[model samples]
Target: MITAEGLTKRFADKTAVDDVSFTVQPGRVTGFLGPNGAGKSTTMRMIVGLDRPTAGRTTVNGAEYGRHRAPLTEVGVLLDAKAVHTGRTARSHLRAMAATHGIPNSRVDEVIDITGIGSVAGKRAGKFSLGMGQRLGIAAALLGDPHTLILDEPVNGLDPEGVRWVRQFVRHAASEGRTVLLSSHLMSEMAQTADHVIVLGRGKVLADADLGDLVRAWTTLGVRVRSPRAAELAAAIAGPAVEIVTTSPETLDVVGVPAARIGDLAAERGIPIHELTPTTGSLEDAYLALTGESVEYHSKEIA
Candidate 1:
């Protein structure tokens, strides 16, 4: 498990992270999400001790990451795939890393095969593609068979097959009771992989809860209604919190109200309703709503 309490970081004139606290337990995959310049990278760096927190503390398996005698065996990290020696082959790189903690040659072979990099084990990392580089980084992280895994954009350069493989692999790791903290911009993949989510905005915690609960908490319940008298129904249901968007002449997307309420309101006004479907919103919708104001960079459309 990993724990952070009152974590904060400041770089000269600006605060990158602020008073963040959360715990990642074993046997589950926790997703870390945020927009650009939201301090996600900084927070991850602090967790692995790459950047010292100005205040508070973070522990991996109940101890500081650097304090562990065999740090690789306690926590596996894949923050950067290109942090390897470009001159070395995949096999040579793994061999050197294993030598550091006295890891066996057999383990290196195991990880190479586990990450599906045996075909290129003899190739130099500099010549490898982005996807191949990511695979090698994962192999190194798994070299020690650590109890916890921290991966940032693990599928950045992967194809569809590779992406699916990573999703299943992380889920399998968590099922075996290993703590996994994953950070990604792929909401669809995160929805399928993570059991919980922690959303950060402008270096502060925005929402942390079960995946479903977080979405429901940030987005208002909405309904899609198809009616012959759509305009009449929309007018009847208009209120302070409700909004009606007409998608077509006979269809309307109503927000801030439940399906049952819309149906009742339409029926009361004698509107001929054909369809009334409820929508609970998606992870992307909730993410945008929660971090709308926290986005640091915005592009203006050209006229």
Candidate 2:
């Protein structure tokens, strides 16, 4: 298990990650989600001992990664695929990382095959495509066969096949009771890949819970009712708190009110409803609803 306790990091005048706390347990894929510059990369760097935190700490299996005798054997991380030496071949890069902990070449080959990078194992790292580079990085992470895997944007530049492969690999790792913490900005992908989600905005965690619970808790349910007297019904449930947007004639997007109340109000007013259906409320809308003004960079178009 990977646990971060009150983890904080300050860069001179700016705070990157502030008093963040979350637990990543084994037997499930815990998704790390946030928009760009939300301190996700900084947090991942701190987890792997790449960045020094200003205060607080993160521990893997009750031990700081730096304090562990065999760091590579404890946790495998793929922060940046291009961090590898361009001059070396993919197989050579894995071999070098393996040599750090005296891991055998046989193990290196094992991971290369496991990540399906065996075909390009002998190709130079410089000539590999973005997808191939990501595969190479995954192979390097699996070289030690660590119990915990921290992958930052694992499918950033992957093809469709590579995306599917990474998803399956993540599930397989967790099925073996190994810890997997995958960070990505893609919400739909996170919805499908994760058992739970840890959402961050700016530098703080806004929501941390299961995918369904987070959606239900943060996302407002919007129901569109097409009634003969739409305006009359709207006035019945009208309030400053309730957000109402009319996208079409005789249709209204109502928020901050339950569907049952809407129905009751319409029935009382003798408004005959023809269409009442669930309108899609986006994940971004849910995030904004929960965090309010905490979201970074609200553009004119987005806001």
Q: Best by TM-score, which number?
A: 1
Q: What are the per-residue Cα lDDT tens digits for candidate 1 across 153-259?
A: 99999999999999999999999999999999999999899998999999999988989899899887778999888888989989998888999999999888889
- Residue pairs with colliding backbones in model 2 are none
How close is every model to the real structure, measured as TM-score? 0.90, 0.82
User: Which runs of model 1 end up more than 4 angstroms from their true locations?
Assistant: 227-241, 248-250, 265-274
How many clashes (backbone atoms < 3 Å, residues ≥3 apart in a chain or on different chains) does model 2 have?
Answer: 0
Task: Work out candidate 2's RMSD over C-alphas.
Answer: 3.5
Displacement of residue 227 (Cα, Å) in model 2 is: 11
How many times do residue backbones clash in model 1? 0
Alpha carbon deviation, residue 231, candidate 1 (Å): 5.6
Cα lDDT of model 2 by residue, 1-303, tens digit: 999999999999999999999999999999987776788899989988999989999999789999998888889899999999999999898889889899999999899888888888998999999999999988888877899999999998899899999999999999999999999877677777899888887889988898778778777778888876888888888998898887777888888777888888878888888887876565556655766666576668765
Query: What is the lDDT of every predicted structure here?
Result: 0.93, 0.87
Collision count for each candidate, in order: 0, 0
Residue 235 Cα positional deviation in candidate 2, in Å, after optimal superposition: 12
